[model samples]
Target: MSPTLEFSFRIAITVDAPTIVSSDPARGKRQLIPILGGEVSGALEGHVLPGGVDSQFIQPDGLCRLSARYALATKDGTVYIENNGIRRLPSAFTANLFGDDMGFFKHVPVEDIYFKATPTFEVDDPRLHWLTESVFICDAKRTPDTVNLDMYRVL
Candidate 1:
């Protein structure tokens, strides 16, 4: 059988407003999204401190590609996390402009977007040495102020 997956952890990432870097007709919309703070729960519990950013590229095909680099402090020590993913936002859902106003729209539920990410953890702490060599993937979701993720390890 092929290698299976094992639950790793869930990261609740807080964020500030995104800063759009550039709008290009051919390349797409470039963005630098600041990561404020949040927490990591589940198998590995920790906190996602501030001072990180998620770089996003919005394609005309409704797919937004992202490369997020951040740091997390686990019980073992500080671990650097690099997460890359893609998110699909339908035009109809994001047509209305709102800032953290998803709760008010009871008529529409959270956008059923296709979001997936591959996260790699780098740490020197012996307690979490295994994470450095592990292969992990995540299910990514985003709210106005937060990006919720559930990471799994290939086992």
Candidate 2:
């Protein structure tokens, strides 16, 4: 049987500028993007805690592998999130997107890129244990200063 997806929630994450950690030709470019907090809506409502980080490795061809770690504070309790994903852009837009100039990100058509993620949740509250028991995926989008994620549960 084919699995179906149910919309879970959406997270609008505010971010700071990317800090380039290394630029080795063989290993690709490494960067760290700080999470400045944001909001969550839909089934799960909360505020993203500050100090989270999104670490990325961009290949020469413009494929980015990203891992983001953050926390959400809700009425039920605090949930920790680890989201990992890949973003593939057209070769022509690679340099501008990954380079010091990120103005291109604002202009690129979302249809031309592939951005997706899988997120795992950890919560201490028994009431929120459902999050840890289910498998979740996310459709992600990137803006000049924010990353928006529409999460779905796999069933």
| Top candidate when judged by lDDT against the true structure | 2
Model 1, range 25-143, lDDT digits (tens) per residue? 45667778889989998867889979999998777554678999999988888889999998876666543222323332344344576789888888868888888777898988777
- lDDT values, one for every candidate: 0.78, 0.89
Clashing pairs in 1: none
User: All predictions: root-mean-square deviation over Cα?
Assistant: 3.1, 1.3
lDDT of 1 at 27: 60
| Candidate 1 RMSD to the correct structure | 3.1
Tens-digit lDDT string for candidate 2 (1-155)? 99999998999999998899987655689999999999999888999999999999999877899999999998789989999999998787877754765657888887787899999999989988999888999999887778899999999
Say which candidate scores most in TM-score.
2
